[model samples]
Target: MIVRLGIAVRYDGDPLVDFTPMRFLDRFVYRNPKTSEKNARKGDKNVFRRKAYDPLGIKKLAVTSEVSALR
Candidate 1:
């Protein structure tokens, strides 16, 4: 299986001035040979930078359950 993950930023009024592009870095990749399932474990703490005016701060979308079957 192949899994694609990402993040989304939501705001009420306006976008932030110092908005940096977010990325889903697959530091480690895992796959179950028996079940043919693939996954990535990302638990880095310094994933994003938050500004004072940022309402959402830095949020990571669900990545665990976003897997696709590789057929």
Candidate 2:
């Protein structure tokens, strides 16, 4: 779970609030433009997919690798 903290405001002469908390999932879903003809025939025109990545894993690998001797 991802927690986002920020201030929310209304432009219609509303009182200021301290902060707002928003919750989100680790996985994200988005529509793909390249939809297959079979899917379109089945009434599923938009192709939805999830993008997965591990930033921590890449950072760890970079830190553990040996530095170049030319430096």
Candidate 3:
């Protein structure tokens, strides 16, 4: 498994919405409950920044919109 997960999109601007992902996210991602807002914005702003790109897990990654779309 990769050390980090890159968020490919922004889930902001929703007032009344489906927050189910937040719950599921806690299972797979390491969340700082106290500073999640700031940390999420900075880290998730770049979708490819933290993706491991090698057979052994490197830094350079290749991600397409279809990748998240498939999930």
TM-score per candidate, chains pooled: 0.13, 0.17, 0.15
CA shift of 66, model 1, Å: 77
What lDDT is reached at residue 42 by model 3? 75
lDDT of 1 by residue, 1-30 (tens): 123545555565434533423312222234
lDDT of 2 at 62: 54
CA lDDT, every prediction?
A: 0.37, 0.47, 0.55
RMSD of each: 26.8, 16.4, 22.4
Q: Across residues 8-66, which tens digit of lDDT does each residue of candidate 2 receive?
A: 64465423432222212212234345656777688854556554556664354554456
- Local distance difference test, candidate 2: 0.47
Model 2 bad stretches (over 4 Å):
1-32, 45-71
The superposed Cα distance between candidate 2 and the true structure at residue 14, in angstroms, equals 51
By TM-score, how accurate is candidate 3? 0.15
Query: Which prediction has more favorable TM-score, 2 or 3?
Result: 2
lDDT of 3 by residue, 1-71 (tens): 23377546555656454457776687658855454575677766554467554653332333555554565
Flag regions of model 1 displaced more than 4 Å.
Answer: 1-5, 16-71
Q: Which candidate ranks first by TM-score, i.e. highest?
A: 2
**lDDT value, candidate 1, whole model:** 0.37
